[model samples]
Target: MLKVVVTGPLAVGKTTFVSTVSEIKSRHTEERMTQAGALVDQLDGYRADGEAAKTHTTVGTDFGRLTLDERMVLYLFGSPGQQRFRVLWDDLVRGALGVLVLVDTSRLEAAFEVMDMVEAADVPYAVGVNRFPTSPVHSLGSVRAALDLSPGTPLISVDARDRDECLDALIAMTRHVLAPLESV
Candidate 1:
């Protein structure tokens, strides 16, 4: 089985993506949001269902498993997106085969630090643009330019709430991970 890390900035849909694609019962370490966290957690203009804002925050990690075919399986690990949880990223990303970094077009800058950590770990990664109702509709080129991603990196539009869209992003990451081996 390949271990794939699902990561991004706060409220970028890492948890939702994992839950949508995972075949097994997903495990989440989510905590109810309190007013005290409002200072650090930004929910403004971010809607979980296009109607209501998210009420919980991931405190530890979210886990799920997906079987792509008879021979391939993916163990998905979703890291907490808050900045305070960054210390755990190294451990979460350790030994990961690849990473799926979700981004909110409305808050593209929030992704830089997460991408930096993933790059520093030297793991192959793809970016998933999760467009919420309030998010600006930027072209893939614009998103790539804004994120400063390389030409070869996979960047795709993904609706984290949709299974098919999430699976497509995962498949893209899998192909990306296998490309180097295909040449060798």
Candidate 2:
């Protein structure tokens, strides 16, 4: 089994992205961390489903499993985004194959910290721009410039709520992680 961790800044669509692609139901541990800041986290045009209710905070993490094909089974770990919970990153990434760093174009800088953490851990990763319906469209070049990524880094736009888009992002990450071997 391959461990895959999805991480990003608060409300970057990590949970939604996982839910879209996972064959098994994605487990969510989200609870309202702060009632006062509820308005701040809202994604402009995005809202949770009717059945969704804020818990308190994701004290631990969200877990899910996805079967990419007959040969690979992916276990996904969704880590909380707030800096206060950053201490959990090491544990969550312990055996991860690679990470999917989701970013919101409106808050592109929010992904910098997460990217730094993953790079420090020496894990291969790909960046996914989670596009919000209300967000202004930005070219891939502009997004790459904002992230300051290397030319070889994979950067793709994804609708975190769309299954196919999420899968495409994961596939891109997988290819990145295996590129060295694929070229051999």
Candidate 3:
């Protein structure tokens, strides 16, 4: 079994992405946003990404399961997007196979922190761009350049609401994980 961590900034669709692709019943720990909490959690970054205001947010974590085949099963854990909830990251990242960091083009800078965390954890990862209807289109090269991604890292475009799209990203992630082993 492989454990894949789905992480990204607030409102980057981490919860939605996990929900769309998980084969088993998904468990999400979301809480309705209160005005007091909103004051502490700034929306500047997400709004910059052209996301509509979010009413609820994932406070703890989201859990789901995916079976690639009879021999391979992936347990998906989506960490809370908010920085305040990073207390759970240590627990969430244990024995993770890899990470899928979702990025919104409108706020490219927002991905740096998550990428850094993944790197610090020394985990292999793939980047998935969660495409929204209003998201600006950019060439793969430009997007990779903007994110400072290496040639080997997988960067796939997907719609969080679309199951096929999410599945395609998962396929890309699997290939990324296997490429080095296959070469050796």
Candidate 4:
């Protein structure tokens, strides 16, 4: 099975994305948010009511599986988004075929660190702009420019709540990562 890592900033919907696409029950290491914890966590734009909008956060990794065909199955590992959990990134990405870095347009800046970690891991990656209802609708070109993505990098819009959309994004990343080997 091919491994893929799903990473992004806090509350960017990594858990939801995995759950929506997984054929089986996905494993999550989520914990309920506390008032004290919310003060330290970045809760802006997640909800109008702040911490109330986000009741749970991923304390560890999220895991899911999707079988593409008889020959191909993807094992998805979702790394926790908070900076404190950055140490887990190396292990999560060690053997990953590719990575799907979900981004919240409302907080584009938060994505830089995640992207850096992915790049440091030296894995092929695609950027998926997870559009929340309150998120601004930026053009793909503009986002690419903002993220400083290479021309060949795959950048697509994705709805974390939608299974088909998430699947398509995964396919795009897989295709991009595998393209070179296919040529040989």
Q: Which candidate number has the best TM-score?
A: 1
Displacement of residue 62 (Cα, Å) in model 1 is 0.6
Q: After superposition, how far is residue 94 of candidate 1 from its true place, in Å?
A: 0.9
The lDDT ranking, best first, is 1, 4, 3, 2
Please tell me which model should have the higher lDDT, number 2 or number 4.
4
How many pairs of residues in model 4 come into backbone collision?
Answer: 0
Clashing pairs in 2: 31-55, 31-56, 32-56
Question: What TM-score does each of the candidates earn?
Answer: 0.95, 0.87, 0.92, 0.94
Instruction: Show the lowest summed lDDT stretch of 10 residues, model 3.
Output: 43-52
Best by lDDT: 1
- The reply for model 3, stretches above 4 Å from the true place, is 45-52
What is the C-alpha local distance difference test score of candidate 3? Answer: 0.86
Give the C-alpha miss distance for residue 66 in model 2, angstroms.
1.3
Model 3 vs. true fold: TM = 0.92
The alpha-carbon deviation from the true structure for residue 124 of candidate 3, after best TM-score superposition, in angstroms, is: 0.6
What's the lDDT for residue 123 in model 1? 97
For residues 1-184, what per-residue lDDT tens digits would candidate 4 score against the true structure? 9999999999888999999999999999999888888667887648622334888889889999999899989999988988878778788889899999999888899999888888888899999999888788899999999999999999999999899999999999999999999999
Q: What is the Å distance of residue 4 in model 3 from its true position?
A: 0.5
Score candidate 2 by TM-score against the native. Answer: 0.87
RMSD of 4: 2.0
Note the Cα lDDT for every prediction shown: 0.92, 0.82, 0.86, 0.89
What's the CA RMSD of model 1 in angstroms?
A: 1.2
Candidate 1 to truth, TM: 0.95
